[model samples]
Each structure stands twice: as C-alpha cells, then as structure tokens.
Target: MSLEKQLNLLKQIDNCFLALNGKKLPSPLGVLDRYLWLHEKAPYSILAQGGEEDPYFIYANNYALSCFKYSLDEILSLPAKLSAAEENRPKRKLLFDKVAREGIVYNYNGDRVDKYQNTFRINDTIVWQLEENDGEVWGQGALFWSKEKERPRLVYRI
Candidate 1:
C-alpha cells in the first residue's frame, strides 16, 4: 500500500478504536508495523466504505478481499452496495444510517454477494462509523464473515 493509503486506513482504525474505547491508541512505532499485518490477516474480514453520496469501498483488508474474491484494486473500485443483493441494499442502508447515529452496532445479520455473484450470509457483525478528533465522519467499517461452513450455515437463524 502507498504510505498515504496506509496512513488513511490507520487513521480510521485509530479513530474507531478511540470511539469504542474512549482513547487513542497510537499506531506502531519505529518497526512494529506488524499491527497492520495483523489486521490484514485477521480471521474475519474487515471492510470500510467511503463517505461519498454513493459510497464505494475505500478500505478492505486482505481477509475481506479474499472472502469477497476481489483484488484490492477491484474491491476499491466497486461500491459497497454491490456487496448486497438489490433487495438487501435497503436493509443495509438502514443499518448504515443507524450506525451513523449510534457509533456502532453489534451482531448485525445480512446477506452479501461476492465477485462471482455467490451469495453468503454474515453473522455476529460489528459495524461502526469512523470519526476523528473533530468529529468528522470519514465513513464506516465492518467486521464480519460468512455464516456457514458449506454453502450455507443453516445453523442459527436468530
């Protein structure tokens, strides 16, 4: 990643954590840049959309890109709405609006689509808005994953 992109992503992460924890946790210093690598290789996916009128992805970790079957460039080039089916977009927009007001929402459930149009459901999601020191809204991010081992989980619907 370019230094500018990396810094932008880290700023959002830092601000999100700040909002969640009531403090700022500084990024890696000197050579401890592994903090970023850890996020990239996180077990679940991490995704963020920009604050445009029609938001497109601005940040997607390696795990998210892998799960969504898109390259960094491809995912960044697409709008976040494409992740959900047409019918699901309204539901997602509602959640996005709620998060815009609530700072964060937990355990959100939703259906998502991949690059090949494969369908999947996400569970135990945590979605939140990105805010900085001056309370500027950068966008939002989500941590979630497919709710299944096979084609579909069929586990718990609640």
Candidate 2:
C-alpha cells in the first residue's frame, strides 16, 4: 500500500494510464498523489498489472484486496489470471485482447474467483491498457465491482 518510495514507478504507471485518454496526456500531477487518490477514493475494486515477460499484478487497492481475500504482498505476487477460475480464463483472455485492441472495454461482466475458491460476479468493468509515452504497452487495469445480490454467470467460451 505504500507507493511513496516508488515515485518514478508511480509516474510511469500514471503515464501508462494517461495514454488511455487518446492523443492527449493527463494534467500534471505527481504520480504518488494520483495513486493515493485512487487507493483511497476508488469505490470498488481496482487492479493494475506491470510490464514483464510474464506479467503479474503490480497493484490492487484495499477494496480489491478485500474482494480477492488476499494481502498486498500475496496479491502482487499472483498472476492476474488466477483471479478467474480455470474455466473462466478464456473469457478473461478475450476481454484482455479486446482491451488491448480497443484501448478500453466497458461493461465486462465476468465471474472472478477469489483465493479461497469463492466466486463473485464482477459487473460493469472498464478494462484498459497501460501504455508509456512512446506507446509501449506496460500492462493493464480494470475497475469493477462484485454485487452481493448477484449470482455468478456461466462464463462463455468463444
């Protein structure tokens, strides 16, 4: 939860997120502040990944941590795919691909399984890529919610 020491990394992350804005970058603000705002103010779950040969989760706010039932270190160490059940990975991958190609994909309803095998239906997701100033893809992020009253749907394979 402490990203204060990761100033440069935070800036890079913010820059990647800003790229989703199309041709224009976001207003100037220290990356730390931006991240703090997200960590504190975001209503639902927010998950972020990083640029790596085999990418893993780099960030997850408190709500996300609670939803997934994982501690910060544990979540960050996990592959984001693990968030879904085995049968749901294909749908998740399709969503990932769609986000990569479209820059943003909204209303993505997916069945996300937590660490203890509890399944939750994540609705109204906004998934997008994180790209650097030069358009280099870093990773991705999604803002979504799991409604308590909702049941998890059958994840389609297509």
Candidate 3:
C-alpha cells in the first residue's frame, strides 16, 4: 500500500480505537476488551487475551480464524503463548515485563506462531496494562497483524 493509503488506514483505525475508548464503552478489562471489539468489527483481524496459567485467547475474528485454520471456539481454547515460538520465549517475557511495568507501549514488531505453529511477522503491535478501578493490575496487550495490506490482523491482550 502507498504511504498515503497506509496513513489513511491508520487514521481509520485510530478513530475506531478512540470511539471504542469513548465513554460509550466502559474501560476495557485490559487490552483484550478493546481488541475483542476491534476484531469483531474488523473480521479480517485477530484478537487474543492472556491470563496467568497461560495467555488465554478470549477472541479471534473470522479472518484470524481462517488464517490459523481454526474455528472461533478452537482459537479461544488455545493459550496465547502457543503463538510464540520456543525461541521467542525470552522476547515474549520481555514483552510481559513491559506490560507489567509501563501500562502501555506501541509499535512492537515481532513474529508469532499460529495454532499449527506456523510463524508470521507482526508489526505495530501495542501493549497496555489492564487495571481494575481499585488499582489492581490485571494484564495488558493490544496487537495486530503487521501486514500493511490488511491481509489479516491478530492481537494479544493479557
């Protein structure tokens, strides 16, 4: 895509993000909630949520499902770490640290494995800390597919 087109797409995505963050939507249960809605609307996208035992996937839109060759139920049942190749474990841990300490980060580029363990590149992935109203930390992440052509997007929120 041309730079202009990419910029326009980013603008549209930003608008969607803002709209979702607007008062109409409650504060997300971390990045997962936001990604879940975004992926739903952008069926060509993917979204995953993580937790303690494993990075549980709470959502995966149609496109993501097709890309990974899995149904929604199948994707949700898988762990988020399943997307991380064994060699990338250390990097994933670093990402976890950022989410734990910073509350938010952006433009993270990396590779992720799919349900079948196929690797794909991801760019512009964002991570954000999830907190309760009581100030308790939950988990954090907001990621999307790195492809500029909009082939498919996947997000991991934990």
Best by lDDT: 1
- The candidate maximizing TM-score is 1
* lDDT tens digits, residue span 27-79, model 2: 22344464555564445677788767557998787778888999889998998
Which residue segments of model 1 deviate by more than 4 Å? 1-4, 21-32, 147-158
lDDT of each: 0.74, 0.71, 0.55
2-100: candidate 3 lDDT, tens digit per residue: 434433433333433343343221223444445345444453343536446466765455556666667767776777777679899789879878767
lDDT of 2: 0.71
Better of 2 and 3 by TM-score: 2
Better of 1 and 3 by lDDT: 1
Q: How accurate is candidate 1 locally (lDDT)?
A: 0.74
lDDT of 2 at 13: 49
Better of 1 and 3 by TM-score: 1
Show the colliding residue pairs in model 1: none
Clashes of each: 0, 0, 6
